[model samples]
Target: MDVRLARKYTVKLSFEEIRLPPFEDILILGKKCPQGRIGVFRSFDFLVPNEFESYEVEDKSVEAVFINKRVLKKINNEKIIEILQERVFPYVSESEIIKVDFKMTIFYDFIEGEL
Candidate 1:
């Protein structure tokens, strides 16, 4: 007696408009993320050169954080990290890459003349 087995495979397809850099303002990379810091940094450099700044963290969950340099000009780097620690880091995992659309609003006062 002989026995035969048959296998079938199903494929699903989806389309998305690719966005360069992917993240809008910030990208939080977990410690064990599939793509390491150097690779991500290099890609960003090629895609949007000098546009982002990388910060390697010494935390348990998060490995590094990438912020738009423009954002850095408006906000302190340490303060941004502090905000992430409190609001975002708690929900991230070692194997995840989280994209954050960090938005900021600033209010300023102007003086007509200087004394």
Candidate 2:
């Protein structure tokens, strides 16, 4: 009888700065996401107090949307909801949590004595 043993191991390591709240401007939680809206909200509230706002969506795929309050300042709530439903909801699933890097650009025109 002969016995032979061989073992090989490969390891990879990477490191990056930890991002607070682990997300950017938006966090979209599906209906069946692992973490409920309240838990997620609490975590965000603790990390960045009064910075994020959560809202429930009426769509079947999306459970809720957590948007930065600063974003709300730039865009209205109704418009935000409308954009999510029209663009993002169709790609989301009931059991998924999605992180969105939202960006807003504003334009303004001013003329002297045009009030």
Best by lDDT: 1
Per-residue alpha-carbon lDDT of candidate 2 for residues 1-115, written as tens digits (9 for 90 to 100): 3344565679999999987988878889999998888989888878998988889988888889999888898998889889888888899999999888889898879756755
Q: What is the lDDT of residue 41 in candidate 1?
A: 95
Q: What TM-score fits each model? A: 0.79, 0.83
Clashes of 2: 0
lDDT tens digits, residues 1-115, model 1?
3344565679999998987987779999999999989989999989999999999998999999999998998998999999999999999999999999889998778858778
CA lDDT of 80 in candidate 1?
Answer: 96
RMSD (Cα, Å) of candidate 1?
5.4
| Cα lDDT computed for each candidate against the true fold | 0.92, 0.87
The candidate scoring highest on TM-score is: 2
TM-score of 1: 0.79
